[model samples]
Target: MKLQPSAVGIVVADMAASLAFYRSLGLAVPDEPAPHVEVPFGALRLLLDTEETVASFDPSFTPPTGEGRVGLALECDSPADVDTAYERLVGEGYRGHLAPFDAVWGQRYASVLDPDGVGVDLFAASS
Candidate 1:
């Protein structure tokens, strides 16, 4: 048997809010909403499902109690884009984890919490 990572699924309580955040990042997400949405990204996919949608399929399913279990790092066109994108999301009312800054690891990095409180990192190579 062989296994390869494919899609990253995020269970969101509010699909509308989730879509807005990803769209701001330049993802080609459709305007029409649904309980589950999959945005194609090259060979990979970003999947979003509502909490109610998951619970309907699995009776024992329950949302995590707190934060920091899963995180996603996204690349930007440039360091300035990282700052712009971060501010855009925060301005749109999403929770900003860390204000965009030049990290010691040599990248411009920032974080914003999705509607479900999942960490979605925005970064770019420091220039």
Candidate 2:
């Protein structure tokens, strides 16, 4: 069996706010506005949808409770990239959850929260 991961869906309380927040992080927004938007990132696309839209597909679907913390993990090319990305996120009005720092494991990483309170981690390999 061949399986490939195409997209990851995130439920947001406010579509526009979430879209704007992701766009500021360099993710491309769809040309048209809808309840959902697909953002292309390298070989993968992230599907961003409103909570209502997601619930429509699965009535039993419930968004993770408690601030929707810990959403996505994105890897960067270098430790410097982590710092740069974190800076950009902060500039775009994202709340900085954790400042960029070198981990004991030797990876540089940082965390930020999107408009919907989803945590995104930026990490890069250290040499």
- Highest-scoring model, lDDT: 1
Clashing pairs in 2: none
Candidate 1 weakest ten by summed lDDT:
63-72
lDDT per residue, candidate 1, 1-127, as tens digits?
A: 9998899888887899889878877889989779999998667899988889999999999976567878988889999999999988899899999999999999999999887788989999998
Model 2 poorest ten-residue lDDT run: 63-72
TM-score (all chains, Cα) for each model = 0.91, 0.82
TM-score of 1: 0.91
Q: If candidate 1 were superposed on the true structure by all CA atoms, what would the RMSD be?
A: 1.3
> How many residue pairs collide in each prediction?
0, 0
> Residue by residue across 1-127, what tens digits does model 2's lDDT show?
9999888878788888888777776678854558988899678888888888988989898876666454788888899999999998898778999999999999998998988778888999897
How high is the CA lDDT of each candidate model?
0.88, 0.83
Residue 114 Cα positional deviation in candidate 1, in Å, after optimal superposition: 1.2
Give the lDDT of residue 71 in candidate 1.
Answer: 92
